[model samples]
Target: MASQWHSLVSQKIFLARNLLGQLENSNSVPAKEALLQGTIELGLRARKLVLIMIARMYQHQHSQPDSLEALGELIGTHSPEIAELNQLASDGRSWWNHLEQLERHQGNPPMARKTVSSENVIAVAADTGPDRSKQALETTLGAMKHFIDILEDRHSEW
Candidate 1:
């Protein structure tokens, strides 16, 4: 069971890295969009898997974290990288969900109506442009790598 979880985590990290490579080389708008979405999805999945692995490895009473933010807390350590990853995942998920919804209005009187188009959605996802989105993905990849290393080191102790 432990080995199975390890294998799953490895696969997710590999897939995310592969998607990042494709995203870097993608020049077409549609291709970039698809790659970006894939990267975000993989990053989130990898994070969850890492959290689960950590909980299992440490023999936590709960055996599962309530949320990404709860992982570090459960382990009795605080990691800024984990926090950053959480934020990145949240932002990416929001952007993706927003893209699906297209237009959103706020307030009972509709104080403001925000309409999202493909071009602007991409920009918003990255905070400004593709460069930012790439940076976010890279950050997520780095954090995943860091956690995986920690998981390996801890696993060897048992």
Candidate 2:
């Protein structure tokens, strides 16, 4: 289970970075649109995986519907590391929520097949607020990395 969680985090990180690379190199409007959608999808997936990692580390199963909140409560009882982890989890949640909003605004739920115009695609691609940037994605990934480290360090206890 731990290995599976780690693999999920790694895969999501790779997908996010790969989408960013494609976004960077994209020239045509349609290509950029597609890549931007891909980035949002990756961000959302990353957020889910991060929460799942935290949940699995503390609890044997990731069945908690609101794992982020549960993570806060669990980690809150820890040492001084709570502050940093809380901040990361908060940022991760906020950005993930924003990405979800963007997805809804695009009328394209994750893994949904729908035909959208280039203009509509551009609009969704440009849906950037403070929370929906590359930095947010990076922050979320960093938090996941920290969670992984903490779990690995205390694996014997678990």
- Which structure among the candidates has the greatest lDDT? 1
Per-model TM against the reference:
0.56, 0.57
**Model 1 misplacement above 4 A:** 60-62, 69-132
Model 1, residue 63: distance off in Å is: 3.8
- lDDT string for model 1 (1-158, tens) is 45566778778878977888888688899998788767666765765676777676666745777466587777655554355445645674442222222212111232354677776664433222233367656655666666577667657677
The superposed Cα distance between candidate 1 and the true structure at residue 78, in angstroms, equals: 9.5
Q: Residue pairs in steric clash, candidate 1?
A: none
Q: Write the per-residue lDDT of candidate 2 for residues 1-158, one digit (tens) a residue.
A: 65677678778767876776666577898987786667667766765665566566656484543445565675454634345445654663644445556656566444644588775564345333334455665665455556656755665365
Weakest ten-residue segment in model 2 by summed lDDT: 123-132
Stretches of model 2 off by over 4 angstroms after superposition: 62-64, 70-84, 89-128, 131-158
Error of 1 at 24 (Å): 4.1
